[model samples]
Target: AQTVTQSQPEMSVQEAETVTLSCTYDTSESDYYLFWYKQPPSRQMILVIRQEAYKQQNATENRFSVNFQKAAKSFSLKISDSQLGDAAMYFCACRSGSARQLTFGSGTQLTVLP
Candidate 1:
Protein backbone atom coordinates (compact mmCIF):
# COMPACT_ATOMS: atom_id res chain seq x y z
CA ALA A 1 0.00 0.00 0.00
CA GLN A 2 1.16 3.53 -0.79
CA THR A 3 1.07 6.09 2.01
CA VAL A 4 1.70 9.82 2.14
CA THR A 5 2.97 11.56 5.25
CA GLN A 6 2.95 15.22 6.35
CA SER A 7 4.83 15.64 9.58
CA GLN A 8 3.73 19.23 10.10
CA PRO A 9 0.25 19.70 11.47
CA GLU A 10 0.26 23.47 11.06
CA MET A 11 2.39 26.22 9.55
CA SER A 12 2.27 29.97 9.12
CA VAL A 13 3.87 32.39 6.71
CA GLN A 14 3.60 36.09 6.13
CA GLU A 15 2.23 37.61 2.97
CA ALA A 16 4.71 37.97 0.13
CA GLU A 17 6.99 35.44 1.79
CA THR A 18 7.88 31.89 0.83
CA VAL A 19 6.96 28.65 2.56
CA THR A 20 7.96 25.08 2.01
CA LEU A 21 5.95 22.14 3.28
CA SER A 22 7.57 18.77 3.68
CA CYS A 23 6.05 15.52 2.50
CA THR A 24 7.26 11.94 2.33
CA TYR A 25 5.71 8.76 1.00
CA ASP A 26 6.16 5.03 0.85
CA THR A 27 5.33 3.17 -2.32
CA SER A 28 6.25 -0.13 -3.85
CA GLU A 29 5.58 0.84 -7.44
CA SER A 30 8.23 2.65 -9.40
CA ASP A 31 5.85 4.47 -11.73
CA TYR A 32 3.59 6.10 -9.22
CA TYR A 33 2.49 9.75 -9.12
CA LEU A 34 2.63 12.51 -6.50
CA PHE A 35 0.34 15.48 -6.06
CA TRP A 36 -0.14 18.54 -3.89
CA TYR A 37 -3.72 19.56 -3.32
CA LYS A 38 -4.96 22.79 -1.75
CA GLN A 39 -8.25 23.08 0.08
CA PRO A 40 -9.28 26.55 1.09
CA PRO A 41 -12.03 27.65 3.43
CA SER A 42 -14.39 27.15 0.48
CA ARG A 43 -13.56 23.46 0.76
CA GLN A 44 -12.59 22.91 -2.84
CA MET A 45 -9.75 20.55 -3.64
CA ILE A 46 -7.46 22.15 -6.22
CA LEU A 47 -4.32 20.69 -7.74
CA VAL A 48 -1.36 22.85 -6.75
CA ILE A 49 1.24 20.74 -8.54
CA ARG A 50 1.99 17.24 -9.77
CA GLN A 51 5.09 15.10 -10.35
CA GLU A 52 5.41 11.92 -12.34
CA ALA A 53 7.94 9.41 -11.02
CA TYR A 54 9.46 8.73 -14.42
CA LYS A 55 10.30 12.38 -14.94
CA GLN A 56 13.71 13.45 -13.69
CA GLN A 57 12.83 17.12 -13.69
CA ASN A 58 10.62 18.47 -10.96
CA ALA A 59 7.20 19.85 -11.84
CA THR A 60 6.38 23.53 -11.41
CA GLU A 61 3.29 25.70 -11.80
CA ASN A 62 3.85 29.42 -11.76
CA ARG A 63 4.84 30.33 -8.21
CA PHE A 64 4.43 26.72 -7.11
CA SER A 65 7.15 24.13 -7.52
CA VAL A 66 8.05 20.73 -6.18
CA ASN A 67 11.32 19.37 -4.89
CA PHE A 68 10.87 15.73 -5.74
CA GLN A 69 13.52 13.29 -4.54
CA LYS A 70 12.58 10.07 -6.26
CA ALA A 71 15.08 7.83 -4.51
CA ALA A 72 14.00 9.02 -1.05
CA LYS A 73 10.32 9.04 -1.99
CA SER A 74 10.09 12.64 -0.87
CA PHE A 75 8.06 15.40 -2.51
CA SER A 76 7.99 18.87 -0.99
CA LEU A 77 5.96 21.86 -2.15
CA LYS A 78 7.54 25.32 -2.24
CA ILE A 79 5.27 28.33 -2.45
CA SER A 80 7.29 31.23 -3.77
CA ASP A 81 6.12 34.76 -3.06
CA SER A 82 3.24 33.41 -1.06
CA GLN A 83 0.08 35.42 -0.86
CA LEU A 84 -2.86 35.52 1.44
CA GLY A 85 -4.77 33.49 -1.09
CA ASP A 86 -2.29 30.68 -0.51
CA ALA A 87 -3.59 30.26 3.01
CA ALA A 88 -5.25 26.87 3.04
CA MET A 89 -4.88 23.22 3.92
CA TYR A 90 -2.23 21.50 1.89
CA PHE A 91 -2.57 17.79 1.32
CA CYS A 92 0.00 15.39 -0.07
CA ALA A 93 -1.47 12.59 -2.16
CA CYS A 94 -0.18 9.46 -3.87
CA ARG A 95 -1.70 7.54 -6.75
CA SER A 96 -0.73 4.80 -9.12
CA GLY A 97 -1.74 4.22 -12.72
CA SER A 98 -3.58 1.05 -11.72
CA ALA A 99 -5.59 2.62 -8.90
CA ARG A 100 -8.39 5.13 -9.01
CA GLN A 101 -8.02 6.09 -5.37
CA LEU A 102 -5.57 8.64 -3.98
CA THR A 103 -3.90 8.12 -0.63
CA PHE A 104 -3.71 11.47 1.19
CA GLY A 105 -1.83 12.66 4.22
CA SER A 106 -3.43 14.12 7.33
CA GLY A 107 -3.03 17.59 5.83
CA THR A 108 -1.06 20.69 6.88
CA GLN A 109 -2.94 23.85 7.73
CA LEU A 110 -1.25 26.93 6.25
CA THR A 111 -2.05 30.31 7.76
CA VAL A 112 -0.93 33.37 5.90
CA LEU A 113 -0.60 36.40 8.13
CA PRO A 114 -0.82 39.88 6.84
Candidate 2:
Protein backbone atom coordinates (compact mmCIF):
# COMPACT_ATOMS: atom_id res chain seq x y z
CA ALA A 1 0.00 0.00 0.00
CA GLN A 2 1.17 3.56 -0.89
CA THR A 3 0.54 6.70 1.05
CA VAL A 4 1.07 10.41 0.52
CA THR A 5 2.10 12.75 3.30
CA GLN A 6 1.98 16.52 3.49
CA SER A 7 3.80 17.94 6.48
CA GLN A 8 2.44 21.47 6.18
CA PRO A 9 -1.21 21.78 6.97
CA GLU A 10 -1.37 25.38 5.92
CA MET A 11 0.70 27.88 3.95
CA SER A 12 0.45 31.58 3.19
CA VAL A 13 2.02 33.72 0.51
CA GLN A 14 1.94 37.42 -0.26
CA GLU A 15 0.64 38.45 -3.61
CA ALA A 16 3.17 38.31 -6.45
CA GLU A 17 5.54 36.20 -4.40
CA THR A 18 6.39 32.53 -4.48
CA VAL A 19 5.31 29.63 -2.30
CA THR A 20 6.44 26.06 -2.13
CA LEU A 21 4.32 23.20 -0.73
CA SER A 22 6.03 20.01 0.33
CA CYS A 23 4.92 16.41 -0.22
CA THR A 24 6.47 13.00 0.27
CA TYR A 25 5.22 9.51 -0.39
CA ASP A 26 5.95 5.90 0.48
CA THR A 27 5.56 3.35 -2.24
CA SER A 28 7.16 0.15 -3.39
CA GLU A 29 6.14 0.49 -7.01
CA SER A 30 8.79 1.78 -9.38
CA ASP A 31 6.46 3.09 -12.05
CA TYR A 32 3.91 5.63 -10.99
CA TYR A 33 2.79 9.22 -11.32
CA LEU A 34 2.69 12.04 -8.80
CA PHE A 35 0.31 14.95 -9.03
CA TRP A 36 -0.59 18.22 -7.38
CA TYR A 37 -4.27 19.04 -7.41
CA LYS A 38 -5.80 22.33 -6.37
CA GLN A 39 -9.29 22.61 -4.94
CA PRO A 40 -10.60 26.07 -4.33
CA PRO A 41 -13.68 27.07 -2.34
CA SER A 42 -15.73 25.52 -5.13
CA ARG A 43 -14.27 22.12 -4.26
CA GLN A 44 -13.33 21.15 -7.76
CA MET A 45 -10.03 19.35 -8.01
CA ILE A 46 -7.85 20.75 -10.75
CA LEU A 47 -4.60 19.20 -11.77
CA VAL A 48 -1.74 21.64 -11.27
CA ILE A 49 1.19 19.52 -12.29
CA ARG A 50 2.24 15.91 -12.71
CA GLN A 51 5.52 13.98 -12.72
CA GLU A 52 6.19 10.52 -13.99
CA ALA A 53 8.57 8.40 -11.96
CA TYR A 54 10.66 7.55 -14.98
CA LYS A 55 11.14 11.14 -16.10
CA GLN A 56 14.13 13.16 -14.97
CA GLN A 57 12.75 16.55 -15.95
CA ASN A 58 10.31 18.11 -13.54
CA ALA A 59 6.89 19.10 -14.78
CA THR A 60 5.98 22.76 -15.18
CA GLU A 61 2.98 24.71 -16.39
CA ASN A 62 3.10 28.49 -16.66
CA ARG A 63 3.39 29.80 -13.08
CA PHE A 64 3.22 26.32 -11.57
CA SER A 65 6.10 23.87 -11.27
CA VAL A 66 7.09 20.77 -9.34
CA ASN A 67 10.32 19.67 -7.70
CA PHE A 68 10.15 15.89 -8.12
CA GLN A 69 12.89 13.95 -6.34
CA LYS A 70 12.23 10.37 -7.30
CA ALA A 71 14.99 8.84 -5.20
CA ALA A 72 13.78 10.50 -2.01
CA LYS A 73 10.11 10.07 -2.97
CA SER A 74 9.54 13.79 -2.66
CA PHE A 75 7.21 15.81 -4.88
CA SER A 76 6.62 19.44 -4.10
CA LEU A 77 4.75 22.22 -5.84
CA LYS A 78 6.06 25.76 -6.45
CA ILE A 79 3.66 28.57 -7.27
CA SER A 80 5.34 31.69 -8.64
CA ASP A 81 4.03 35.27 -8.71
CA SER A 82 1.13 34.11 -6.66
CA GLN A 83 -2.24 35.63 -7.28
CA LEU A 84 -5.18 35.95 -4.95
CA GLY A 85 -7.12 33.57 -7.17
CA ASP A 86 -4.45 30.98 -6.52
CA ALA A 87 -5.61 30.58 -2.94
CA ALA A 88 -6.96 27.10 -2.44
CA MET A 89 -6.57 23.72 -0.81
CA TYR A 90 -3.78 21.84 -2.52
CA PHE A 91 -3.54 18.06 -2.39
CA CYS A 92 -0.67 15.81 -3.32
CA ALA A 93 -1.73 12.58 -4.99
CA CYS A 94 -0.21 9.42 -6.37
CA ARG A 95 -1.49 6.82 -8.83
CA SER A 96 0.31 3.68 -9.72
CA GLY A 97 0.63 2.84 -13.38
CA SER A 98 -1.57 -0.17 -12.87
CA ALA A 99 -4.18 1.52 -10.73
CA ARG A 100 -6.77 4.11 -11.64
CA GLN A 101 -7.38 5.30 -8.12
CA LEU A 102 -5.58 8.23 -6.58
CA THR A 103 -4.24 8.17 -3.05
CA PHE A 104 -4.23 11.75 -1.75
CA GLY A 105 -2.75 13.58 1.17
CA SER A 106 -4.87 15.45 3.70
CA GLY A 107 -4.24 18.71 1.91
CA THR A 108 -2.58 22.06 2.47
CA GLN A 109 -4.71 25.20 2.75
CA LEU A 110 -2.92 27.93 0.81
CA THR A 111 -3.90 31.47 1.66
CA VAL A 112 -2.72 34.27 -0.56
CA LEU A 113 -2.28 37.33 1.63
CA PRO A 114 -2.78 40.71 0.11
Question: How much does candidate 1 score in TM-score?
Answer: 0.97
Per-residue lDDT tens digits of candidate 1, residues 1-114? 998999999999999999999999999887789999999997789999999999999999999999999888899999999999999999999998788899999999999999
- Stretches of model 2 off by over 4 angstroms after superposition: none
Root-mean-square deviation of every model: 0.7, 0.7
lDDT score of residue 54 within candidate 1: 94
Q: Find the number of clashing residue pairs for candidate 1.
A: 0
Top candidate by lDDT: 2
Give the TM-score of each candidate. Answer: 0.97, 0.98
Model 1 misplaced stretches (Cα beyond 4 Å): none
lDDT of 2 at 47: 90
TM-score of candidate 2 on Cα atoms, chains taken together:
0.98
